[model samples]
Target: MTLKICVAQLNYCVGDMPGNAQKIIDAARAAYADGARLLVTPELAICGYAAEDLFLRASFIEACDDAVNRVARELAGLKGLTVIVGTPTHGNTGRGDEAAGGLRTKSMAVQQRHNAARVLREGEVIATYAKRELPNYQVFDERRYFTPGQGICVFEAGEGESAVRVGLLICEDAWFEEPARLTKEAGAELLVVINASPFHVGKGNEREVMMQNRVRATGLPLIYAHLVGGQDEIVFEGRSFALQADATLAGRAPGFKENMFQAQVERAQAAIKIIATTEPERGDDAELWDALVLGVRDYLGKNGFPGAILGLSGGIDSALVLALAVDALGADKVRTVMMPSPYTADISWIDAREMAHRLQVRYDEISIVPEFDAFKASLAGEFKGLPEDTTEENIQARIRGVFLMALSNKFGSIVLTTGNKSEMATGYCTLYGDMAGGFAVIKDLLKT
Candidate 1:
């Protein structure tokens, strides 16, 4: 018997409980319409991934629970369909006081939170699996917000003849061998892992290799459903995929985009097989480019920004920023300004104007020489003994910043800073001069 499954690789915003639940409901309905018996959404799809301090508040946790219930109710009409949703839920604190008569009292329960994946069927949650492993390194802080859960979660899908036992796991649980081993020992035929792992160079390939190891170890087919979007400085590349029990690639979704990835699993007696269409692999450079573009697009679009404005220098840094902004927001929505000081070269002006013209964005030049002279004149008394130094050069940059910010305020567009990681690390860029923008598009990238 064959079972069809759909992975919802979607973008979710943090703290948007109602909006996030609606998106999940919509995805579930669509997946059911596509004939999928099982639907898997990414980690924390209910209240969005990593709600941070919001998770500490009882009201926020209550809202998340309500949203999960709403999703379950909203998806009840889709008969014969089972959905797995990631969320945060209260758990046992595992501590209790002793009674006065030397009798042990009941354990204090539901005082802590757990990163959970819940199974919803017929408008009710049938089962839930809490994440056992909590990662604390790098960008992950699961240990800080949640308590670890124990044991395995193996649940049945479909009817007796074609039924498959699926083991559920959150993001970090799949990295270790014991979870899958214990799950398979509990009579699970397949494993489904939901995640909201952030993007880094070559992180996609690393995930594929790790999942393959788990499949080989457990001899159970695996499916990875990942989140996609830009949140603050981090970005999630979807690339949801599946692996057969033999560790071969079964299917893959495109990276840096939202997709409803599909796969079919055939269960015959004790044997199981996975069949899916594999998406072609992308090069590192291509993947990086798409990450930047998606990051910019989602960051601006989700934040309700109409357009972007950035200082356009003739150098490669600002030029690359302009290209990305255009690709993300289009040329019509982007505007550029060239603020040249008295020390600016004629070639810089020529190059800046030519590039803006080729891109077909609004470009204007505002000379900062007058502002530079005024600053010098005003500070002459304070620096009578001191010779002319880097302070004067910084004034030029500050003058340019004033123009860009003024333009940004007059219009509703956000200022996209063009400073790269190298300049930021070495303090080559001025604080209020080059770093005055609302968003830093290339702040994490180094100059090559």
Candidate 2:
């Protein structure tokens, strides 16, 4: 017999409990309608990943719990449909005999938060798997919010011949050998890992390789459901995937986009097989481009910004920022101002205007020469004998900044800063000048 599983690669906004819960419920119903017996959502899909300080609040945890219950109740009517939803829960497991019943029991005294996944079926939570590994390095701060959970979660899906024993693991759990090893030892036939892993150039491939290692070690087919969309500065690329027991690529969803990725598993007495399409791998450039676009789109779109405005200097930094802005938020929503200084060449504004015309965005020229002259006149007495240095150059930049910010305040558009990583790291860019903006599109990228 064969069992179909669907991975919901969804974009969830942090702290949007109601919206996030609705997304999960909608995806569950759709996946159930699509003949998927099992559905898996990304980590913290109910409240969004890495909620930061929100996790520390008891009300936040309660809201997440309520959302999870809502999803379970909403999907209860879809009989035989099992959904594994990631959420943060307040509970601790009590010691119990695994052979008699389940491994988890509610402890009323302890109120520690756990990064957990719940198995929902027939309007009830059948099992819960708390993430064993809480990633602490780099972008992750899971250690600060959640208490590590012990024990393995292996539940049966379907019935009779088609039934498969599936193990549960959160993002960091699958990265370690112990978690998968214990789950396998607990009589699990398959592994489903839900994640909210942030995007970095080659992070997609890195995840697949790591999951493949887990597959090889345990001889169990695995499915990875990842979150997509930008949250603050971090972006989650949802290239959710599945792999065969032999470490073969069974299937993969697209990156930087939401998708219902399905994998059909055929269960036999001897072995289980996973059947799905393997999407073509994207190049590094394509991945990076998509990350930038999604980052900008979600940052503005989620935050309720009407559009973007940038000071187009006609240089590579501003030029790139303009292109990204236009691509992210259509040309009509993006506006560019060519703010030229006294030292600016004719080619600078000329090139800037030409590029803006090509992109068909609202383009305007506002020379900073007058403002620069005023600033010099004001500082003339203070710097009577001081030789000209970066201060003069910075004054021009700050003047341009004032113009862009004024337009931003007037039109309700966010200013997209164009400073690259190198300049920001070396303190080369003006603080109130070049750094005046709502978002930094290329803050992480180097000048080169």
Candidate 3:
């Protein structure tokens, strides 16, 4: 028996349930037309992952449930095809009253919300598996919103000889060995894990290694479906994959790109086999570049930013950020302002203007000498005989900040802060000066 599975690696906007559900339905139709029996999407594909405080809103959860139900209803006629859509569903446990009246179900409380994946088949939810592990470390705060799921979800898709028992895991659930081990013990021939994992350098390789370990430990073939998009500060690199029990890379989707990756899992007389396997080219620098580009593009597009503005210093940090911003938002949408202080060299100004011209973006030169002098003179009476130091340097940076922010306010452009890890770690950057922006391009990035 051979079962075709489609992995829908998509970018979802947070709080946009109707839009997200429409995407899921479109993908389901495409997958079914392509002869796929099962379709899997990234975790929280219905309401977007890492929704933060939105999970607390009763109306938000209600809307998500309604959207997921709409998806199930829209794709119900596709009989025999099972779709596992990720969402936040009200858990059946806990002893709290509904957060709001008539918002959610009468029995379930809003505070019992679980990070879950719903198995939809024929206009109904057959089963659901909540994320058992809630990561609460750096850059992850799932423990604040979601309750750990109890038990595993293993169901048989299709009937008779063509049937395959599939188990579901959500993001952090796949990290620990318990969920996979329990699912495999519960007679799941293949595992489908949905994730919204954020990207860092070499994170893809690390994920592959971890999946290999799980495959070897559980002795069950697995399909990992990860989201592709940037939500705020996090970027999900969608390198969804499938692996054999022997830790063989059977199928893989490209990283940092939205794709509908398909694979055929056939149950042979002896064991299950992967009939289709496609591995995309891999490079560390190329992957990093893609991650940065996608991060900026999605963050701006989803947040409704018309364009971007950054202060170009002619230094390496701002230079790289300028290039990335241009690449992500296009030259026409990116604006650069070069603010020169008294200590700024002529070559710095030349380099900044030349780069802006080469990029073909809107460029302006604003001299901060006036503002710097005004600040120094205003404070001169207070420290009459004090020698100048970093305070003056910080004043210069603040003047630049004011100029950029004024432009941002007038034009509705987002300010892209450019400060490398070294400057941030050594406290070389000003709090409201260089760090004054709506977003940081390389906050976690190293100076190397």
Report the C-alpha lDDT of model 3 over 1-448, residue by residue, as the tens digit: 7788999999888899999999999999999998998899999999997899999887998999999999999998998989999999874443444456535554563358889989999899999888899999978888888888888999988667878999888877778899999998898988888988898888888888998888898988889999999988888989999898788899899888789999898887869887656767578888888888898899889989999999988898899899999999999999999999898998899999999999999999888888888888899998788888888888888888888999999999999999988889998799889999988988767788
Task: Give the poorly placed runs of model 1, Cα more than 4 Å off.
Answer: 92-110, 384-387
Q: What would the per-residue lDDT of candidate 1 be over residues 1-448, giving only the tens digit for each residue?
A: 8888999899988999899899889988988888888999999988787788888887888888899999999988888788998898885544444444544444544478888888998798999888999999988888889889897899887655667899998888999999989998999999999998999999999999999999988888999999999887889999999998899998999998889999988986688888888889898888888899988998898888999999987989899999999998899999999999877888889989988999999999888888888898999999999987788878888888888999989998999999999999999999789888899999999988
Error of 1 at 106 (Å): 12
Model 2, position 436: C-alpha lDDT score: 93
Give me candidate 2's TM-score against the actual structure: 0.95
* Residue 61 miss distance in model 3 (angstroms): 1.6
- Report the backbone clash tally of model 1: 0
TM-score of every model versus the real structure: 0.95, 0.95, 0.93
Off by over 4 Å in 2: 92-110
Q: Model 3 lDDT vs. the true structure?
A: 0.88
Clashes of 3: 0
Q: Candidate 3 — which residues are off by over 4 angstroms?
A: 92-111
